[model samples]
Target: MITTAMRTRASIVPLLLALGCPQDGGTASEGGPGTSDGTSAGTDTTVPTTSAGTSSSGPDDPTGDTGDTGDTGEPPGEPSGNDLDQNALFTCRDQPALPPADLRLLDRYEWTRNVGSWLSSDLANNPLYPRPEHRYSTYSDDEALDPSVLGLYLDSVGGAADSWTIGKWDGGRLRTVHEDPECQCFLYDAAPTSECVRYFVRRYLEFGALFRPASEAQFDALLAFTEGVLAGAPDVESRPAVIKRLGAAAWMSTGALHRPELGAGEPDEHGRLQLGDWELANAIAYALTRTPAGVPSVNRSYNAGFSKGDVDGDLGSILDAARDGTIKDPEVVAKLVEEHIGGIDEARLDLLFEPHDERYWETHSEYWMAHGVREFFREWLDYGELAAQTPKVEVAATSAWSGYAVENSYQNQIVGFYGYESTLDYQLDDMIARILDTDQDVFANLLTSRMFYTPATAGYQENETSIWKSTAEANRVYNVSGITPQTREGRWIELPQNERAGVLTHPAWLGAHALSFENDPNLVHRGKWIREELLCQNVPDLPITVDAKLSEASKSQSARQRMSEQIDADPYCAGCHALMNPLGYPFEIYNHAGFVRVEDHGGPPDGTSNLVGMPSPELDGPVTSAIDFSQRLANSRYAKRCFMRQTFRYFAGREETMHDACTMVAIEKAYDDSGGSFTEMLIALFNSDSFQTRVPD
Candidate 1:
């Protein structure tokens, strides 16, 4: 837990700013210190100059040799491939241990992606105008998994192996099957029937025996076997042919095999299809394993010449008969339908369906519909279970704060309920409202008293009247009558003992500041601002390890002088500051007013500045574009971890402490397990013991 003294000290300046009552006689517009050069004073030293002549090798250039080890200091040898020491691929040990809950969370993220892909495959080539593209829009059944529907979809799209191709097809032709190179063996001539059986079997084995819920050794063995099979050369002429032959041969039997003969298909009065027992068995097995050649089996009709309505009516009747016991066994009903339905020609099926009409069929009866149903059922089940097992943590309704406001005169869209005259004023008002609405007594009290209006102490001007009014409202509402006049001195200041406790409230304004100043290139800056203001984390002073030689030699200094110097000077400071500074520097464009300013103190107004001394020297240049900054921020290690931690806190609804290492570890692990989704982390946190249980104070 953070110390009270630190919280008090941090709360004073912000509280005064929040009160709309400034001690300084000057108006808010006449704010102190609009901009600082951000340079440190140091003694000058003579440095050698280098010519601007082009060279094959430059100080910042990467060595082109494959054998070049660079400065990583890693051993120059092939990594061991053994499971105990699998150094070739990135192992979990190489990185910090993520929470186990994070793994489950990541799985949820991947599951969503998988479901999205499934939905896309179902909706591709759909005829419906403005067809739903996302999974939420299509194929949700809200029930148990409809294996039959899923199987039909898999058959039409050629299973997961052909998901990419399936995704390319429009909804108009969902039933229209295409011969995919990936699954050519399952649809082509000279493709043995046994090969189709083996292909499905292999898929099942891979999914069930090799993936999660299976042991690592089992996974390794399966992978090894697959690799061996792929590496081996067979007698087939082409790679596809080899794959087909291997698939076929794996399931073929050399001895005498029992074959079933097809009978003239007509049902008796009892509605049972006139099929031999052996024939029925064969058809059942085929339905389970055989890949459809052209159209999906669901849309295929045994009686193709019949009217469209009649064909649909017949299917409905058949299904109804099976349900009502008029057809007795489902297997019998299935057999009768198969015989009556004319088998679609694999090659000609695509030609029969109009591309424009296919979307309706998919929407009405496809995997997307089924998936939606499944999701609904899962949610229902989970909700019931949660209600029964866990006590709900009640959070009061809070004001929504709109961070930064872009002055879009054309759009008059209002977000938060707090109505201020201007966008900036509205944002500040919204922040004050959120602080007032906090459910925690300590947090609420702190925000209301010493920490409410202190934007200026943290280097922001609180000249806006709308901001001041909201702060006064919060103070009155929370009944903090005795807040000392001395506490309202600066934009940021420490709170007195009678004012407040807890670190969350002191950082609330900082959090608002960070959000208000957010821009793509300024992500690092936002992060640094958050760290300094909210968490009160100490950021070390800048060092001087930059390319002094280059800067001293050239009349025009290199763009990365400030960043490079700090990184190169002290190795101890290099790691943390390097991580923090670049992330913060990107947000240099946001000034004290919480408005986007394209210029730094001495640079161009377009916020195209760059940081030097990064892991890659090639990236050391002026970041003149938002894309460059966004990519750097998104890919930063600290940004990723901080995001994870914030998500954890939001869902867990509590401060993390050293004693909660196991929970933290579990949460981080879960994030890694899941594919890093905010939603997944939420679910994992909700399902965690820390979230479910109430700890005694």
Candidate 2:
């Protein structure tokens, strides 16, 4: 069957690809043409690239000859196909392994996204999800569940279940579900003649609860409850009884609230407990993305329409097909790598194109990259406080925005959130995706590439629009070295140089890491993020007795001047501050307001920066600016391994430990072998024993 998604995409594919991928007006391939079998799917998904990640020169190639492959040693015009192999200079070594932890319990973000998939619709568009508090981190669910959080989940889940059954209770839905079901909602609604509701409930419980259907015991118990609900019903049409039963299961059931993947049976030949289909599905989705199982892969939005014919509901279909060997003999173990984990389709590749406000794509392209990292950058960079970003702090002599405070919430908004957007957030996020998706040397593209998107009028002196944050007050000054603004409200891609190379200079990272009125960038925080997140090294937490604060006397000097003098004066604070201050001072190129500047209110900016404490022989030591640091970082083996290490912790939801050493080595190898494909690194992790094995209950 041409899936509903495929049918819809058949017509719009050309338009979407043309907008972003200049090389993809023709039928394209996914993850390039180098599949395990080395055969192409021949789907109109991506512009096929050579094994080295360069666009293929074919009759349909829309992006013409990429100039010269000459010396100067850049990977031709395609520029490393996302610059995947940027770390070719570093010597490969066995790196420290990542630790795997029991990934139990649904994080709040996962819970909400999964709920929408089970029901096969975007409930957020209907204004159904209740946000008790803003979510900054995916791990917030690891903490003790709050009463308000539980309440929010209960209400939203119930609403979703009710919405599905209510919309489908009429004739043909039951047949539509059983003949060829879409998601669990249709599967539940397919129950014929109330007598078989128990059998269907068992199936859904297995699917939605994140548990195995080892016995009929749980199904029998739930059936008893359904019989009780039906007993209160009037006569023949006991549909209300079924809906109520499904709703209850969707909320109160174990799988509904927790990620319970109990150990099942004998150890595989590898000694890892073989996870069941449901467990595998849940884990795979959690590792790669938090989007609901059945959600479309791209152009998704709150207002995006929901159709009943879609088959992307849960992991059951893919896993079941693999086991039965129905289509091609799928090693389900490797299926996790090839299809879901490693592979890319046209939908995702299309997200690279900015819509220009005319195409009305359903979702943004960058969500794929964001979801891949277990650590959400919004929380990591502290941009979750986007709502609090205001015009209160006037940037010094920074054009019209110097005194005018504009807080444009329409930055780059993700689709499912209740009508929110931000260009600065999206700009950085899209850059991350472009890097990970395009090439090897993934870190090279991630750190050193200077491309970014921004409003055409970001630097314009005049503005009129007003919304959550006054657009006029919020119109950002385009002060980065490499970018040039293209439109008033839309984003255009621009590549910058020097300190503009990586996310360190992106507005989202800069804005989130800065102080409100301190105006000077927080060197300590910036340095800390680099040391921990990027370099994968831990600086000891400060002592409780020690309060490292800038004295009033010190505050008058420029941030650099004050910081340098203060650190020099205090022997105790100097130890940790040394790790962060020097590394962070490079970003003094931009103010805490996220606009570029040569100096701060305090002192002249220090143009020189360094990769302090980096253990890599090639990457460590002095650098000139953020751009220089980004280039060195991309070239560092230590930094690249740490990045992959971060990728593992994010998906596995654990810290790196000795137990995970061997598997982490496999991941490191994949990064090197795949020429820096971030997708390859993820595939290696998912396919490893650490991701598949669980601790026995």
Candidate 3:
């Protein structure tokens, strides 16, 4: 009998098949990079090798590392990356049955991110836009199962290639041995200069997008589907049309694109598969840069399996000589920081690509053609979620006419405060850059840093004021330029340490978590971000049956008064609300604009709440304000461990499970031992058993 989980995936295949293949009737197929020729689009058919149970000894796969090449029914011992002894770690170290060997589909972000990597274009055109973010708060264990994403994923895949050009980014050269210039849409032909376009597209779907191989049967089905796409194109022979068809088909195809493993080696006696070295390389690459930078070169075998070779020509290709053995994990992270994240050393100049003024700082951050974790965090934090198209709502007018702009208050006032100049997001980008550069106690520094960048706005640029560090004092005792009466602009202004904290007090975060009409702090939201994004905790959704309403009748009372009446009264509400509300109340000292406030204008301010449930034994207690809370958070063991959990999720591309406990503990130990360095934490995760182990269904 099929299990419920098995049945769920079984149902998805037919639904995707029903979306139907490309429409017929067009110019005949022609040879292209990584493809073959045919008289008609649908007539040409080929069967690629299956992902499993295959031997690899191709020219490209000379090493033939058997790591991820084919299935070895025999169980391999636990993979590496585990620093702790299993017998001493936990009783459940020997997991009998690994997760089912279901295929893992890309969520919307990964889909766009992967394809964008292939094309060498920074693709902002994502189908997953304007949906619930696959974030820590909404994350569920079922998410790893490919079947869950089928319905929402279909439309995204179908139209994704609208802007794609096989040869656009890499100057149209489909180089296999080396990507002097590469193209996701461009396939490889046997000739050095020509394209085996069809063949290459299928392989890319497996290696680039799916991060796995496909079987002969799977390729036949995918080819049939691609041929169907040609049925509808007005001109099938159009090279662009064909290229788009291949990318879209592979992207949308459910079965091949979604193959997942517990991390991949043979099953253990308890039936466990360790994630292979191949996948470990991938996990490290994607987490740091948010692309398939770590994937090894494939053999020409039918399944096109793996060997230990670097990705030919992309951002990570820079590490070709060092990735395999020379560099330790910390060095790997160091290289990524220097090359991929370049914004930290400068201030952002929105209109000009390069800075004209000399006194301010290095204001040039854009690299001609590149994508990285900076891009990933842009989506990860949903910083521009309010600015997305399709869900067109008037944001400027919503604060008065209606409180219904999609992200008006959140985006416009906070992240995009200075119109198109997203100073806040850039600030965040800088923070990540700095964290990676220093790579020590990253979580604590992020929470406690007093450094911030203030742009050289019109006032300073126009000579109305000086853009110097001394000019930008954050304390209320002094002020500066007319535009920024509280603080001036330019460089990394080190504020008075006691008066400021990290991003929690940042205007972007504060504004994002506040209201439009009342312009008050949304403690629940502010607190939730900390719990979910930082601590990796989930405050369960309010029960649907209950209205879960907020009361606002205290006209004479302050913002907290209105919320306290409703949220604190219901025992059912307290179950979840308590986790968030406690931390949120501390931020009442700041307004939506992120300016300091000693008093509330309306009534007495109650900026006090119990800081409880942190994993640390002594850190849980009453905190006086957001300042105190942030400082305590920087010191808490729970917060640091939680930071690792987020790292695992970011790199692993899945939420951490109870089964991941030993891995998490080991990573946390590395963090502790390494003086809480983010670099070491990353090393710990990539070098662990979980990083290299795969679990079969």
Q: Write the per-residue lDDT of candidate 1 for residues 1-697, one digit (tens) a residue.
A: 7542233233222212111101111111110111111111111111101111111123565431223321111223422111111111212222221111100001111221221122233423222111122112111112111234322222222122232122223321112223223234433434334444344323322221111011222222333433344445322233343332222221111000101111213433422223322222222222221111111212222333211212111123332332233443544543543333222221322212222223222211111111112222222111112212221111000111221221221011122123211222222332332332331221223223344332211111146444333332222111222321312232223344332222222222212323222222223444455344222244554456743222334223222333445343668655765556554553343332223333343454343555665433434567643334544434444434444444343333223333234444555555566544332333344343333222110
Worst 10 residues of 3 by lDDT: 20-29
On a 0 to 1 TM-score scale, where does candidate 3 land against the true structure? Answer: 0.63
Instruction: Please give the range of 10 consecutive residues that has the lowest summed lDDT in model 2.
Output: 31-40
What is residue 629's positional error in candidate 1, in angstroms?
A: 2.1
Ranking by TM-score: 2, 3, 1
Error of 1 at 564 (Å): 12
Model 1 off-target regions past 4 Å?
A: 1-527, 530-583, 598-603, 606-622, 625-627, 650-676, 689-697
Number of backbone collisions per candidate? 82, 38, 61
**lDDT scores of the candidates, listed in order:** 0.27, 0.47, 0.45
| Candidate 2 segments whose C-alpha is farther than 4 A from its true place | 1-103, 117-160, 168-192, 199-214, 235-242, 268-272, 291-392, 395-421, 456-469, 472-477, 480-490, 518-521, 602-604, 610-613
Best by lDDT: 2
